[model samples]
Structure formats: structure tokens, C-alpha cells
Target: MSDNTTHPERCRCCGTMAVHRRLLDQDPGYARRRSRIEEHAFRAMRGTIVQRPGCTRIPVVVHVVYNTDEQNISREQIDSQIEILNEDFRKANADISTVPAPFAPVAADARLLFALAASDPDGNPTDGITRTRTDVSGFVDDDKVKADASGGKDAWPADEYLNIWVCPLSGGLLGYAQFPGGPAATDGVVVTYTGFGNMGTARAPFDLGRTTTHEIGHWLNLFHIWGDDGTGCSGSDFVDDTPNQGGANLGKPTFPKVSCDNGPDGDMFMNYMDYVDDDTMVMFTEGQVARMQACLDGPRSAIGEMVSCTPLHPKALPKDTPKEFTKEPIKDPPKERPKDNPKEFVKEPVKESVKEGPKDLIKDGIKDGGKELPKDNPKDFGKDPGLEPGKWKPLDPPPKQIFEVPTKQLVEGPVGGKQAFENPLPGGWGNQPVQPMQPMQPAQPLQPFVLATGQAPSGASLKPPVADGGGEQDQSQALLGEYAQLLAQYAQLYQQGMLDQQGMLAWQQAWAAYVQLGGR
Candidate 1:
């Protein structure tokens, strides 16, 4: 085996971009699909579309193509890779706390959950793994490792499962992935055995299983943070939030390193899309999440629609299957008792002998001169002697008392001969008539609702009203119309399975702010 100690440079670490270019050149259909996918991503990003509610579960199939015993990794290693994917994609990795304060706000949980497929293409129970003994010493980025004829195992259906091929990679290459628009036969990702997982035969600096995470990011339609411009300032990863970078950052780079005039908070080298080591890269941004969600909504929607994480037997039907076909026939209940047969239902009463105790307690009390109580009578309670039956007499009114108004008394004061109270309070409160209460001026008609710079307080755009009318009612109507349009768009995306919980919440907050501003 070649020396595993030497790490490849940032540009050569992943071969996804190279594979992408080759596919664009060789297949015309792939190029067209790539264009359409990009257009969809662009729309999603521009609209800031919310993701669908709940976690998206994806079934995975790992194909292990090995040439030696060491290359044939253990089940624990494969499981470790799956767990790492779950953590990294969901932003549940422990290292995520190390993200800088500035970038942490945009760091997002993709809400993508991955599990080993429970059933194979033929609906047979499976462990979600395939091991093939390959004679080829090492596989290149050319994709021979994806087929059985080329000394590798063929992929499962790409539309139903995410195919992962783990083998020894040639030319110091770590891994590569075929993007969403590629042919299904060669779809999915490939990782080197040493860089595939965190345990057994896994090597340092690459053992945390982030290689598969990064490649799957590619599979989910994410571009590198550096924008793949080959050390130029002109490239764009198509994500708006990520800082523009001239080239990929390799190894462990300190925070806030400037490039392409992106200063202060410079290139996001710690991003999973960059070439940093496993322990270094830790996050995916909200913009990247939107892009991936667009892919799930469009090109790759089928794989996530249904997921089975445990083996499924052929005889067992889905939960939604008709009950009549899946369950046993109903049995008749026992007969009810006949109402006419009252004699048979009745039981014989038992005779009881009464015992006397504390005899004549009431009579003894009466003999001791206890007063007898009156008999119960409705007329005896709540009766007023002064009031006639069915008639109420009004009480006489009390005599009114007269109050003497105070007259101003003369006192020695600085103002000559001015009538003043003998004792004057501070602030000119002496001997003055009480001021009549002033009516509150009708609350100053609320100032016209205006959004400064057309932005909500949360920094989301309010998307100005369509009409230019100066009337408040017209402006409010326009704003309401715009809000309604946004709601309609949100509902459509949600129905199409394009929105995730985070995206849905963000859009909800935005429209809620609009409503507060009198949109509706």
C-alpha cells in the first residue's frame, strides 16, 4: 500500500469536481439536468424557501469492495460511518460548539437522517451491506468500483437508496461523489477504506468519517465553500451566506483568515465542503440547507419518500394496507340477556333480624326538656314581615347633607393683598379652584406604518406592497396581498414535500411580522 501518512492538498482531496466535469462532457442529458437542477436551487435560495416539516430519512446501502483482508472493514466501522453522517448532517457533532460566534448563527441542522436499508431491491431482508472481493488493486475516480463486471459490486437502485462504495482509492484520493444529475448506474459516493470511518483500519486526520459526509453533501447538491474557481476570485458556490474564497483551505486553519477581499470573517475553512480534516470541519450553512432541500424536492425526491431501517419480510404488508386483507375475520359476540325473562334474573332475598341499640335516645332527650323543632315549610324561610305577598315596599331616601364651599382666606404673602390660604402648599396649589379634568386627545392617529429600508426587524425583507397608492387602506391591502402570496407559496412548497421544520418556522416568523404590521 502507498504511504497513508502523506495527505493530499486541498484541491486534490476530493475528486467530485473532476468527476462532475467529465460527466458534463461525456453525457449531454446530464448537462441539461444539471442546468435544471441549478435553476431550481437558484429559485429556492432567492425565495428563502422553508424546508418540509420533520426529519428526512434516507435509506443507505454500503457496498464494500476489497482486495485484501484489511480492506474488508467490520460492521462496526460501517455503523460508525452512519452515526457520523447523522451527527454531522444534523449539526449534532460535539465539535460544532467550536464554530466562531459570527458564523454560528448561520450554521444549520440539515435535519437529514440516514439509516442502513432494511430490504434489498428484490424485497428480501438485508443487513444493508454488500461485500465483494475485487481483484483490482486500487480503484480510481473513473467509477469502475461501481460495477460487478469491473471487479466491484453494482449499485442498488439509485432512486430508492443512497449507494456508498468503500474501497482502497488510488492516487492519494480520499473519496468522490456523483452529483444529483449523474446516471443512476454510477450514482452515489465512494470513500477510501482508511478514511471511511472512525475505527478499525481507519487512519488519522481522516478517521472521523467526514469524507462520506462531505461526499454525500455533494450528492445532496452542495458545492464547495470556495466555489471551485481554481484559486480565482470569480467563483461562486451559489450560496449567499458563505464568504467568497479564492481557494480551498487544507489541514487545520485558524479562524478569520482573509481571501478574495473577504476579510475579518474570512473564508469558512471549517465548513464541511472545504478540505479540512475530520475534526476541523463541523457545519453546514442555512443557504446550503436550502440548496439540498431543493434537490430533495426535485431530482432526488423519491429516495426520502419512504424509508425502512429494519429488515422487512415479504409476507408483511405496510401499515396502510387494507385491514380486511391483513387481519383475521371477526368473530360473533355472545348473546345478550332477554328482557322478558325477569323471573329468571331475580334472586331470593335473605331475611335479617334487626338489633336495637341506644333505644329511645330522642324520647329521653325530649323528657330532659329539649325543645322540639318546627316542621319543614317553604313559607317559613326568607320571609320579610314588612313586605306584602308578591309586593316589595321601597325604602325611604336618606336626607341630603349640604357641604360648605371653602372661601379664600387672607394671609401675609409676597404678592400684595392677593387672597391666599393661611397655609400654602408648594407648586402654587394654595386656594385655587380644582381644574376641570381634561379629555384625552384622541390617541394621535397611529403614524403611517412604514418599514425603514423595507426590512422587518428580524432583517428579513418585507417585500414592499404592490400598489403605489398613498392611502393607508390601499397600502394595507397591498401588503395583505403580498402576505397572502407568500402564504400560498409556502403551502405549495409544503405540499410538494419541499419544506423542513426550520425553513417553515423562518417563513412563519417573517409573515407573522408582516401581519403585526397590519398586513391582515
Candidate 2:
């Protein structure tokens, strides 16, 4: 029999709690570690323990285990997911505005940033993505996906890297995560390929990169908002701010959804821990943030203490090179050769030859053989045939301007000859005297400009005068208004998850038309 739980079609199901239970039964040390971790979290939840100030940057390594080409996702998809994580964790997501007003004040910025590791655990440069070809068709929550022996990629060191496995998942499971205090080898989160990111094979209702966000929340020690109680009102997620709820809120539940006598402001279905659709869930509560910080400060403290997202400089040395070479400085070669060496040079003859010089040797050769030597310059070398002695000629100068205005004419006005007035005005004002005209008295201050209630004022029309090309200008303005309206509608539909593929294509076509019509 399969260990996976069968869920209703289209329901959001996670295997984390079940896996946690199984681990508790299988490993006693894990239970002890869990107890310690929960104690730290409790202290953090109260005012006893304090979290480190400022943001914590964690390095991530994505292992892409694929049985087929589609299962092997692209680096772009991986990067998109990372970007989403950064935005969501920092409360920088654009859809945070969708969080209801009642819960908005408690929506916390986790102040955590996740980036793909730029260097592997071995200190080699990496893009932080690993691709493994596996014989297994699909993976489940059995931890087989965390080991190479079982046809999956083994993880990097858990203390230095957050290992995330993306592969084909069976049993309709979207994803699962190993919470803090888990065994090191099987640490980190596993997300199904289709539900991992917003692009590539990611499907709707689960797309928008929320599955990884939800799984990472679990990895950071957050519980499901519904407390994993399966409709029991008594269970708690251990966060005081979050309301006590019966079970996971599937699909998209409207605001003020009453459950477990939690009314007025009911279940915060929009929290990241809830099992809502990607578009529906948009926030993390302050209590959840505190719990995650506690995990970072306790069981996962080592990973957060240092950042390994930057590439290591001067990557690992070649395997064949001696390890001592890196530690010791190389000595200079010997200054002098041994006298008795077989390959010793005949330096005396070389010194004599250098003193004799090439000019002396050339002269002696010419005198002895009486052979005529070639002239220094080769005949006709670089000499243009047309430029020889009497054949030399110069080309005529370029033609002068067709007509030149006289200097006096240029200095004078356009009419030529002389200025209209000999005494031109000062400051280059042509011919008119510099007159100091009297300033007119300010127009009688219009009677306070106040009107009685509902009284009309007597005045000239305030409408602006139409200039030349006003009709075309008006038409263009109207088109601009229409373009703006279309853009606004496009953005609204996109944010609200109402636009389909065809609708997007139509919007693109309309945008192209607007650009062609000279709309900005």
C-alpha cells in the first residue's frame, strides 16, 4: 500500500506533517532535536528570546532531478522562483495589496532573502543549479529523492546551502518540506516541477510560484494556518495573531469566512501558510515571522550566520597539482650553470662574435669575394609611376562657392546696402530708441473675488483658444485616452487572474496598434 494520502481532485495537499510523524517514529534523535527547537520557538514567541536584527541572506541550491526533458526545467524558471521568494519574503510582492485591511497590519516582512549559491560546497564556481538524470519515473515523500543511490541527486551540505529538489511527483502531491531539526542528509524542500514556479510547466490555481513559498515557509518552521486538524476547532497553529480554524482553506474563500467561532474577522485564508490558490494567498503574519526567525536563530542558526551566495574567488586548484604548491613560494632558477655540465654554453666565442659586429663581417665578406652588393634602397620600391620626375602633376582645387555675399551686405540687414536707421537702438534692438515706458497701475483688484452661496459669477469664458491643427490634436488626445483605458484594463485583468492566453495575445495586438498609431 502507498504511504501517500489520497485527496479530492484539485485540493492542495502537503505531505510534510505525515513525513514529520514518520520521522518522529523512525528517529529518536530527531524527536529530541524537535523538542529543543520548539522550546526555542516558544521562547521566541514570548519575549524571552530575541531574534537577530536586520535581514538574513540564505544560499540555495536547486537540484533538478528529471526522467524526461519536460521534467528538466530551465534556469530561467529557477531564477523566476528565486525572484518570487525574495519579493514574497521581503513583503515586496505587488499583490500584497490584496491582503484584507483587518489582517494587513499584522502582515510581516520576514526580512529574509534567498539566493542560489554561486559556489558549491567544494568551493567550485556554480550557477547553483544541479541536473540529475534519474531512472525513477516519479518521487514521493519517502526521502528517496534526497539520495543519489535511489536515483536522485544527493544534497549539498545543509549548513551552507538550502537544497531544493524539483522533480516529477506522483500521488498528486504538489510539494513537501523537512522542517528544522531534521536529519542533515535529507534536509530542505522538494517541489513538484509543475507547481514549482509561475512559468514553464507550472499550472494555474497552483502556479504564481506560491508552492515553493509555502514549502519554504514549512522549511522555516511555520505550520499550516488551519493547524492541520482536519476540521477540528480546538487545534491551533501556535501563532496567537492567526485565528483558530477548522482546516485548510482550499480554492479562494471570501473574506470574513467564519470557522471555529472565529468571526468578525475569521480565518486569515490569505496567509502564506493557508492552502489557498497562488493568487489568493498573499501574506505572512507577524507571529509566523517570529517563529521562522526563531528557527533561524536555533536549529538552522549555522546557515544564517554566514552568506555563501557569492562565488568563491580562485576556485579549487587542479587535482593533479601538488597541494604544497599553493602554500609555498617558488624559488628562483640557478643564476649560473655548472662548469662540468655537458650542455654548458661556449660563452667566450659568443662574446667575441658580439664584439666583432655584423657591419665588420659584411665588409670582410665583400672585400674577399669582390661581389657587388645590392643598394640599400630597392629600385622603384614604393614609387608611384605617375609621380616620377617630369610626369608629376597637381589636381585643380575644388570649385569655389557659386555665389558669395559681399562682407558689407552680410553685416547689413536682409535688404542690403545699409540699416534703415543709422543710430540702432542699444542692446542690438534695430533702430528704435530705448524707451522707458511708465508702468500701468495694477488693474483695480477685482472685488475680493468672493461669491455668495450658489451664485454665478459674471466673467469672460475660461475655455482655452484653439490653435492651428487643433482638430488633429483633439483626435490624438482622444486616442491617447483610449490607449490609457486599454492599458489600465489589461493591468487590472492581469493582476486579478482574469486574462487567458487569447486575452493576452489580444492585448499585445492592441498595444502594437497603439504604438503604430503614434500613442506613447
Candidate 3:
């Protein structure tokens, strides 16, 4: 009908007609079927038919094609686009308040919401995101970006999933979309990576993820507000309520923009379907919402009817559960099981002794340099308390992987050229002259408990205790082992709600009384 030329300045969605032309060229009966659906939708839009009640949730799948690290956008960016869609479609955007007072009453919510598909076409679980690495530098509006053979991914079933392609678009084209009734493999929208979302590569003037909003509006069978005619007064988007505008508005225009002899409130440039900047566009007129409703009821009804089987995230467990009680993969980025490896499919049986061991106790203290000491007898730690290691294991304890409390430092420092003690009485001297304290270095990783034997100029030099000789060392080592057991027992008792502050102190006094009487 019109010139059918490309416009790279504002958008490149004019290629939808080109796709229609190709479909017409290849299929003999396709045009008839497409026209029938379109005619029915148009008739419904004009009140010859009624639209379906209630909102529809469209399942969306985002296909990310990248040639470089910068092009592979983050999940946050993808989520940002989805949020914008839901906000704009449901008339819930924060900026909905910005619509000019005259147009506020005319602005309508389309009653549509979008969600990343929970399951794929074949009923496989998915995050609704597919990432593909490509060698092709960039793409134009040629639709090559829709095919895996052409360095892009093939679309999922169009009747089931709304496939969105995010990649580097050349020629300053913000985005484009195929209207309903196009070929399934090439259906959906393509957005330039830079204009795809609100963050990352998303730049100024197009950074609000509104490019995706505009493109999805096209996907839902909406035409440009100015109707694609080049600056002429005689253009029709085929909707009644939208004021007839001479041409597309580019930037933010003030209220009461006059055009096409429509006075007072002329161009509805704030509409998403218009060519205005992302921040400038705000509302979709009620008539536009009706037209979109007709398309959903007629051509795209299959998509809305497909039931989503996405599972909800499970609620978190109670905070009292010990972390070691929960199972976890031993390796990061869990390695795939080997085909011939015996351990691949077979799970090691949990030893009964380890399973029934005292609640929060580690069976053995960690060895020096992170190695686990080999058991002299497999059942010694579990069966016999008499044979327990008399000395604290010389190694640094295992990295505090279990849920011990986070360590807090008392960090005494100088404030305003004077040292401020949190507890002035504990330092035992009032008005004592001390050197100005320097800023503390960052806390180091947790280390095993060491005895303070010598004082250095800056701080204490604590060394791991060594066993020298007979009864004294034995008694000291035995006391340390007893203390370790007390800690483990106390942790378990506390977790069971049997011990609070006073209860814990009473247990400690009883243990000390037993130790002093040599009752081990």
C-alpha cells in the first residue's frame, strides 16, 4: 500500500509488510486464511463482535544472541524488560501519572500480563531464557536473526511461546516485530541489545526498556498511531478514538500538540505505538486497547489458552535447621557424572555412626593445611569416647563452613584525637595517655584458636600449643577436649530449645566442677 521503505531513524518495523509479501509469494492459500482472521478481528474491533473477558497471561521466551561479552545481557536486564511489559500493558507503570490531564481519562489498560514461560513447548522446565553464541557481527531487519542456520536461534512454537530475540541491531534500528499470522519459525520480536532494557548496554533516550514495550505492542496487532503514512494528514490506523495525527512525533512534545485539524489535544504521541522517545511515551488510548483485544480473541487466542505449568518456588525452611543436615553438591558447577564411573549413579550409604553422631559436632578436627586425617579405626570417633584424641588437632580447624555465628570484633579505635572505650571501666584507668589508634585492617579469614604466649609491639603473637610432657600436658589437653565436647553438646541443647543463657552457664559450671575433681 504505502512506500514499504525502511526507516532507520525511529524504528524498522516496516519490515512486517515485507514478511507478509514473502509469505504471499511462497504460499498460494496463506493470504486467504490470514485475511479471514484479520477481517474477523477488524469486525470485532468495530463492534460487530464482542471480545473475551478477564486478563490473559502470555508465556514469553527470550533468546539472547551475542557476539561479544558486552552483547550477552544479564538476567536482570531481561527481567527489567519483562517488568516494563507487565506495567505498560496493565496500566501499572509509575509514569502512568505523567499522562497529560486531558488524556488521563482516555488512557486504558490492555489487561495483559507477560511472564517468562515456566515450561518449554515439550513440557520441559525452563527459565524462559536461551543464550546462543554467534559469529555474525550484527543484523538488519532481514529476519536472519530468527534462524539457527543463519547464526541465530529458531523460534519456539509461535502458537505456544512468544519468542523474543535480543541482539546487536545495525542501522540504529531500535526494534521490529511480526504481526499475528506470520510463519511460526520467524514469529515474535527483535530488539537491539542497547535498547532492550533499562540497564547494562541500554543507553540514554532509549534506556527505559520501552523499546521492548513498543515492539510487543506491534506483536499484539497494533499499528503505528500515525498509521505509517509519511507526514500526510490522510492516514488511518483504523482505530476511532485516537486523534488523527499528520506524522509521528519524535521527542517529548508538550501537551495540546496540534495537527491534522484536531485542535486542543491533537497528537497522542505519548502512546507506546508512536515513535517518541522511551520517556516521552506513556499511555495507550482505550480504542487501541480494544483493537488489541480483538486480535487476542481472534488470531492469537491459541497462545492465551495454552495453560502454564510453571512450578512455584518452594518456601524456605526454618532457620534452626543445621546447614550440614542439608545435602549439597560437593563441587561447584557440579560436574556431569561419567558414563563408566561407578560413583556416577550410586550414592554412598550414610554411615549409621556418623548419622547418629551428636547433633552439631564435627567427627574429627581438620588437619594442618586442609587435609582430613585418616581414621586409625573407622568406628573410633563414634563408638568410644575413651579413645578420643588427647590433644587438640595441631591443624587449623576446617574453614568455618557450618553455621557458626558470624564473628564480630570489638574494634577499639581513636575518635576525634581521643580513644573512646565502649566500656570505660574495663580499661581500668581514667584519663590515661595512649598513642592515637590507626585505622584497623580488614579482618582476616577465621583461624583456629591459639594461646597468647608472647606480646608483640603491635599485637599479641599467639601460637598453637604444643605437648611437652606428662600429667600437666595430658590434663590440659584433656580439659581442651572436654571443652570441645561441651561446646558441641551445648549447641545441640540450644537448638533443641533446652538451654538459654542461665541454663548454658549452669552447664559450664557443672563441667568445670567435674574437671576440677578429676571425674573424667
| Predicted structure with the largest TM-score when compared to the true one | 1
lDDT of each: 0.70, 0.71, 0.66
Give one digit per residue, the lDDT tens place, for model 2 in 1-520: 1222444346677888878877777886676566557656754564335578878899999999999999999998999899889888888787888888998989988888888998998899999999999999999999899999999999999998999999998887888999888899999999999898789988888888998999999999887887765777755566768988877888889998998999888999999898888999889988899899889988888895443323211113345467667544443323333434434446666666787877798988878655444443345454656465443322221223112333343234234344312212234333333232222223522211110011111121111123455765575556545554554454444434556765554455444434434544
Ranking by lDDT: 2, 1, 3
- List, residue by residue over 32-85, the lDDT tens digit for candidate 3: 555455555544553435577678889999999999999999999999899888
Model 1 steric clash pairs: 51-499, 51-500, 52-499, 52-500
The worst-scoring run of ten residues by lDDT in candidate 1 lies at: 447-456
lDDT of 1 by residue, 36-91 (tens): 57645654554534446666899999999999999999999999999888878777
Best by lDDT: 2
Better of 1 and 2 by lDDT: 2
TM-score of every model versus the real structure: 0.60, 0.58, 0.56
In model 2, the clashing pairs are none
The ten-residue window of minimal lDDT in model 2 covers 447-456
- What RMSD value applies to candidate 3? 30.7
